[model samples]
Target: MDSELAAASQWATESNAAVFIRLKTESGVVQAMDSEEGDEEENEEGEGADVIEFHPEFTYPIYGEHERIFGYKGLSINLNYAAGSLATYFNIKYTKRIEQMESTSTVALKADDIDTPMRQILADSVCATQSEFAQQVVHDTRVFRPSGRKVHEYAGRSSQTEQLRYEIYSSSFNDTESAKYHERMQAFVLFFIEGAQFIDTSDERWHVYTVFERLDMNGQTSYSLVGFSTVYNFYCWPDRKRARISQFLVLPPFQGQGHGSALYSYIHAMVLGNSDYADLSVEDPSEAFDDMRDRNDMRYLLKHNAFAHIKGARVEQSAISELQHTHKLSRRQMTRCIEMALLKMIKSVKSQEFGEFRLFVKRRIYAQNMDLLQALDPDERKHKVAESFASVVDGYRRVLSLL
Candidate 1:
């Protein structure tokens, strides 16, 4: 029994460099053999596995110039079909081939153009092609109840609106079932992101906080998990703890309703509020998350009167300290919040207030670009300064717009 199982596993684990696809039809399954080594018997099995062929070396210019990000080892695609119809689609073509493919109407289709005939050919098909190393976009995402920090009170300051509620889970290695759910939940990030990998939770450093909406119908409250965040606690010097946010995701349905801001506020109040927390960090935040971070941090600082003293020529270290001491923000976060607060004080881009704000940003940029000042010619230097000024002002404009 063990030997048979091992043989089946070995056969299923075989890797190929060509695309494997099966077409589900009313008659039976039909396989497409594009590779030299593809087998009918081997293809008949392992329907759930991924298989594909590869080019020796490939580059994706769409991602960036000569983007070798995926390592270009192999490509796997499943033209999924169910109920005798095409349910999902996959397309893979070399970057250089796209220009040629789109030019012909008979043999090629535009990027957005859907081919109905192609769908019929591969409907209800399974294709498996993957390399030696396994890839899992998501692990487990089922979050168990009463697992972490639950904020029950609504219509209060802790949340943006009393109608919404969230819980912050403190996950570790010992919580077996909850941890699996967390792994599965991490898979959801692939819906919005391209590259997402599972984290080994055996290490004790990870702290997972999941947010959910508390639904109450006829006084029967149920929790629907909405979003989750994973933070790694790193021990700093002097025995202080630095928490770096690894992943922060708020589901699409709950987004744009201030739930993200509310969750952030709760994290700050729960983690950074404590004396043990030295600072907070994020891991390669997306542009949208950065905007949300700026807005929420500024809102928190503004509410605490820390930003009140930094307006109208009041940019002082002591004033910054007041915010730092209250929020326990890292040096980088504090500086960004200060800049955002300074920009918020401005009424218009045409006014003197804007000039002061511009000067404030430019002065820092100038000091940082001293080496540039020494390198560029005088005419080029002016253009560089204007470019930097515009870039900084554009960021301020975004912050202000979000506010």
Candidate 2:
């Protein structure tokens, strides 16, 4: 133990970093030595003596003794001594520790730390899910693929359809600075796809996929393609916690042909199989549907499922106030003030970080939306929208503090 402490002291002296000496035995002891002057101070002149001192530059004055050391075995010794500017030295030492522990530990990766492979998959999936033209291509491919025929023959019969699909799915544009504005649209597509979550099954793991199908009409066949991406918040708070669906996308042409409904049904069933309880909120009815017709279609589909609205069709300001009061925010004026504050928090974030923050807010909105949806009352849905938006704003503020 004496040899080990001496070695640690030597390392501290040479590297100009802090050193801690831990003694596991009752006779074991800890001591601090000044790097500037190899001077040692004895602690109380006792038999099982342990001494520790902090350099002047360290935050805490005189690192003498600690009540407890975190994650240490036996008589753990912790030393955080370093030479040079305090911040820089501490940063370097902390970084070294982090790097050393990264491989063996299940550390959470920051939003910025998400890698390129995951990013690319997410982007592709988002584009396929959100774009109307992309959705159509996917739908066309799935619906048309069963009949085997020549591509040209099918195109000849349905030139308009084929051209529309081709224009939407096959067109390519240069990414160079000289590319035309229309050419730059491809980049926007790429950006949106990449920014969107392909597989947000959880904060820890994301999955993305590009889907393609061949359609056959009589003897002619054409190919259609689409992308599917999902972001799941699995085990976000804890490993045992249930997962939340962050994002789901299917392209435009696929909208009315039961593809979206089918996908949702499949997901719903899958989730139901795994757990007796699962929930998601649909906050953006506008984004969810291309038009009123599409929205109505979705309404019909949702109605078929056992899902019901929580309150009723329309959520009024009064209802929100009532809910707020129930939560103990009580004063109507105070709740309004709080709501405004939350909105400001969200709006204050940098544009690039907005999307990330938006995901966090959307989950809360969804939860509120589910309450309204489950109510199966028309008035409740309207009120739920207002309530849901308020909840989103409030949730955004809370997320800001986390950053």
Candidate 3:
């Protein structure tokens, strides 16, 4: 669909004319009739007549405006239109690409010249309107072909998806051969995900968690590549036994199946319920990942039943620490979760109400820098406080948006 749309667009541009489409039925008959013709035979024969205009947008943009293309070079700036409104129309699809068809979808009326591969095309994706946002890629049975063969498989002794037919494994660098397939899967993220980076999976401290869908071919059971995440064991400030999640990607097609959450939770649960007692943390999380962490962490924290007792209490550093200890969350993660919960405490955002929350959050951000803050002159201290407060409030807003 992406390529077909692009072709229609390119053809229109080249000919200095408009592009139209004809729909073919199951029996390979083009169906339609033009009212202006006023011929009953034309209507009954199913000869093409209804012509639709063609237009296309980059649902999966692989190129930048400045890149060179046939008959075009540098940016093709179309500033006469609003860019903000186009944002939702072209964000990476939130629905996993694995399951490719949405039964109740209309089509997008756009096209481009870019040649997209079959695997990259979302045949089921609909373009109901030119203004449709990426998140609106309606519900579908998302699936993914990891492109990598199953190198390892293990069952979850206790998990939410225990009855499902699939396997997840935590493998290290020792298996050099299967690691290559894992590497092949990274390419998918390059196109569908923004700011995705590859890491050194060779380090001994690096552990990979992978999920594979079990398939049957020629009467034999095999596993297809699905989704994966990477975690690196980082040394604690004073201890040497802490792990931090580094890179995470659920191939576009494999999303919406809870695979990403399952992968994250399985590893997190291991850190929380491990016998050796190592701490868990995330290195640097993207907005989407952070939202996932917020939901997962909050759920885990709520399990203690102690959370209910302090649901209405002011969130303090001590409470953050207690939740961390109870749920195996890093100090940073617990603080973030608390900030999200604190937002729920807003009875109103009137002057005093909002200021108290601001002071509370800034108090935490400035706690470690108090010595530096104290050494400053009075004016400088006030300036620093104002700046710090503003910064924390901005971040709090972003978290709230995610929540």
Q: Is candidate 1 or candidate 2 better by TM-score?
A: 1
C-alpha lDDT score of every prediction, in listed order: 0.53, 0.30, 0.50
Candidate 1 vs candidate 3: the TM-score winner is 1
Better of 2 and 3 by TM-score: 3
Between candidates 1 and 2, the one scoring higher on lDDT is 1
lDDT score of model 2?
0.30
lDDT (Cα, 0-100) at 338 in candidate 2: 33
Candidate 2 segments exceeding 4 Å error:
1-204, 209-213, 217-223, 236-243, 252-258, 281-286, 289-403
For candidate 3, the 10 contiguous residues with the lowest summed lDDT are: 78-87
Global local distance difference test of model 1: 0.53
lDDT (Cα, 0-100) at 209 in candidate 2: 22
**Candidate 1 root-mean-square deviation in Å:** 14.2
How far in Å is the alpha carbon of 268 misplaced in model 3? 1.0
Separately for all candidates shown, the number of backbone clashes (residues 3 or more apart, or on different chains) is 20, 55, 15
TM-score of each: 0.58, 0.26, 0.52
Q: Candidate 1 lDDT, tens digit per residue, 43-140?
A: 33333222221221111212222322221223332332211112223444322222233223444322221233223323233233321001110110
lDDT (Cα, 0-100) at 216 in candidate 3:
38
